[model samples]
Target: MKEYKYTINGTKYEVAVGDIEENIVTVTVNGEEYKVEMEKEAEPEKKKPVLGKPAAAAASTSDEPATNKAAVNKNNAVKAPLPGVITDIKVAVGDEVQVGDTIVVLEAMKMANNLQAEKAGKVTAVCVKIGESVMEDDALVVIE
Candidate 1:
């Protein structure tokens, strides 16, 4: 099954699509299952990418890093307080920032939350881009 997480009207939903047939699909939304009919038959598709536990474990067993999702650049880093999409980044690399400065804006639960600098420092790295979804405690920017 293919899974997708979405936030709509401030509500979060996890949808799984699978067992597709001619013009019908099975979808599970937030634990509730539904059989949906499509307007037309879906076209043949290519293979899906593999990006799950097995692949990650295989990568970790090798010399290379398991993934690039958890990179930290500096000792000082601003992390996401909750799961959300990064709507904007106010500071660029080498930009000086003071405590309480709004470094980034995150959209969660249909609200805009400002991510501020914890201390005065220069921005060393921006780890997320616009429209990127971040999880709680994910490092957003590094300051030094």
Candidate 2:
């Protein structure tokens, strides 16, 4: 699945592309899923080379750390408040946190927003890494 966020005419939309079969595609927008059929199959675009390292590559190769999502308690996961790129992670697995403690820093619209914990607990999962982009409701951490 590929996720993307867009804002048009002051309306924000979170989109996720699921599968593609021939001219039909499965997509989800703002929590609503839909199947869209194309008029015809379009040719694939050629790749353009010779540029600096791509953002995705840089993010993957960065030293920033992340915890294993498979071990996360989904019920206790701390979800993102809005769409943004993760600028920093302030807590790690096994760390103790208090209510209102900044757990992550999210950069949205050029402003860094500190996402704080809602309840006190021990951090059990760090679902996002620095430079990673996330949409509203995406899980960033898990505390229990």
Candidate 3:
């Protein structure tokens, strides 16, 4: 049950909304109860979670060996935001980087996207290079 207060013209009413059977709702005002029929059926509200995505790097598996680079990574990993080919790699292992620094450039949807760092850290590994194609959330760089 939900409680609400409404004012109509110069009159105030305290309402407690209760269970509904079809289009009618059980409501009480003060000490009186009433069954109100809704002209239009009510619909329940729905909500969904939203998440932010980052840019992706473009690359071809032939250009960079994914197996060798990502063989081991630190706790924090920078992932590709979208599926695309790795067009350019901006950082290498052992390089210190700051937030907003372009870690790689991914060519997705025929557009070149610069994938930036979300936090300041050292690049622990480089997972992909130029001409390599990567999928969404693919490991691009591991940061520590």
Best by lDDT: 2
In the range 111-130, model 1's lDDT, one tens digit per residue, is 88999999998887777766
**TM-score, structure 2 vs. true:** 0.55
Worst 10 residues of 3 by lDDT: 49-58
Lowest lDDT block of 10, candidate 1: 60-69
Q: Give candidate 2 regions above 4 Å deviation.
A: 1-67
Q: If scored against the real structure, what TM-score would every candidate get?
A: 0.51, 0.55, 0.52
Each candidate: RMSD to true structure? 16.0, 18.1, 11.4
Kindly list the per-residue Cα lDDT of model 3 for residues 16-91, writing each as its tens digit.
9998988899999975899999888457877332111122322342445556564756357788889997777789
Error of 2 at 95 (Å): 0.5
lDDT for 63 (candidate 1): 41
Sorted on lDDT, highest at the top, how do the candidates line up? Answer: 2, 1, 3
Better of 2 and 3 by lDDT: 2
Off by over 4 Å in 1: 1-71
Candidate 3 residue runs with Cα over 4 Å from true position: 1-70
Candidate 1 TM-score over all chains jointly: 0.51
